[model samples]
Target: MGLGPLEIGLIILAILLLFGYKKLPDASRSLGRSLRIFKGEMKGMKDDDVRSKDAVSTTPVRGEIVPPPAPSGDPNAQLQEEARLAELRAADLRARADQARSSDSSR
Candidate 1:
């Protein structure tokens, strides 16, 4: 039969009588500590589940058939920017070469 409050109280009283008042408090304190530890473990498990659910819902990998949007500044723009930078570098190198050659000729 399911225990009502009266039945539960009697069981608790019996336990207290068996263990004595001095030991009952200590036993209850240990039980409270165990319950707190169990609650903490359950919370951690729930947090991990939420994290995995969020990861699955967000962000895509490379090979998915439904491709992610191309990033801003397309390849053509990047290539043109790279070419411009190359030209600037080449010009700088040419100027340096000319200065060296002129210095040698003057000497």
Candidate 2:
């Protein structure tokens, strides 16, 4: 069964009471901006996924004897690069977990 009119009305009334007439519009506008930002980021992520897939297709497979594409820019650059990439991956994982938690909470 779906939410009847009464339930929907009650939900609206609850929201109105919580936000008050003056702040409601501002709250809704902020929500709209947030949703727009979220939509744009999701689109960007899809584009990035496509690009990464293309990059992966050209990358060497495991156990293949592939020479390094270029010499290190600096002696310690490779080590720093690896550490930076590892940190980025960890951050991505944390963001995914946080997104999952927020979605679950919203439901």
Q: How accurate is candidate 2 locally (lDDT)?
A: 0.75
What's the lDDT for residue 10 in model 1? 97
Q: How big is the positional error of residue 81 in model 1, measured in Å on the Cα after superposition? A: 32
Residue range 28-95, candidate 2, lDDT tens digits = 89999999999999999999899866754454433344445347577587777556555655565577
Q: Say which candidate scores most in lDDT.
A: 2
* Structure candidate 2, residue pairs in collision: none
Model 1, span 1-107: residue lDDT tens: 88899999999899988999899889999999999999999999999889856744453322233334447758887677556655655565577669989999999
**lDDT to native, each model:** 0.73, 0.75
Candidate 1 pairs with clashing backbones = none
Q: Show where candidate 1 strays beyond 4 Å.
A: 1-9, 59-66, 69-107
